[model samples]
Target: MNTANPQLEGLYLALAAMNRLMVEKQLLTHEEIHETLAETEAAVMKNSALDGQSDSHRKAVAFPIRLLMTANEAAERGGEPTFEDLARQVGRTS
Candidate 1:
């Protein structure tokens, strides 16, 4: 969790915040977001396979997917999950 670049961390926070706002405004349901994230993740993984991408590359690409999925899960559980906490969960889950 050594974030050598601050912008990467900012992007993660921004994504999580955007998802939270969308759910809060009822523009998108938590279930909808979760389903979409799952689909996206599957597609990314499939493409990675086809392209013969390295495991490190695949995991790096999956970070945002995991971040969004974690955000949606936190929304469903009525919990405010931090970016660091979500990032840690993503690593463990991955």
Candidate 2:
């Protein structure tokens, strides 16, 4: 397990708690939570790259960040948030 970043660990913990809470409240099915978590983790990992890049590359990177923000918002609202939802919200459609 990587513990190099406390903030990332904290986010993982918070996401776990959210999953438990959603399950307890019946806001999300167990499978749905599991899938969402997996997708979220992948998205976070992909966006973790911070290589120096051109302005165009940075602009492209913003797409994932925006999708993540939308996903977080939807999760907070107890909505049935999924990777598809995030993609659609960000106009990525994928």
Candidate 3:
């Protein structure tokens, strides 16, 4: 989206890399991460501050959640999945 934060791109990639590391190292299960992602999505969706925001504003805020969700999906499929792959899969293309 045009509202996407350019600076947060790194954070998105970092999240993917961290996910790969976590899975490779057996630090967390995919299901655990998915559960946490769901919890985060729920909490954000319930935030009062988001109630009056425009769609673009809300999507900007949801970028990280979308990234993680797609990244997790890619991981479930097998092999190393980068954040860029997740981004593309989630239609985050520039």
lDDT of each: 0.85, 0.56, 0.71
10 residues in a row with least lDDT, candidate 2: 1-10
The digit string of per-residue lDDT tens for model 1 on 1-94 reads 5668678778877887888898889899888889999999999988998999998888889888988898779878988777788888898999
Q: For this target, which candidate reaches the highest lDDT against the unseen true structure?
A: 1
TM-scores for every predicted model: 0.90, 0.37, 0.71
Q: Report how far off residue 63 is in candidate 3 (Å).
A: 1.4
Greater lDDT among 1 and 2 belongs to 1
Q: Over the stretch 1-94, how does candidate 3's per-residue lDDT look in tens digits?
A: 3337656777777787798789779998888888898788677666735577665665566668877877777777875565566666666441
Where does candidate 2 stray beyond 4 Å?
A: 37-94
Q: Which scores better on lDDT, 1 or 3?
A: 1
Go through the candidates in order and give the clash count of each.
0, 0, 0
TM-score of model number 1: 0.90
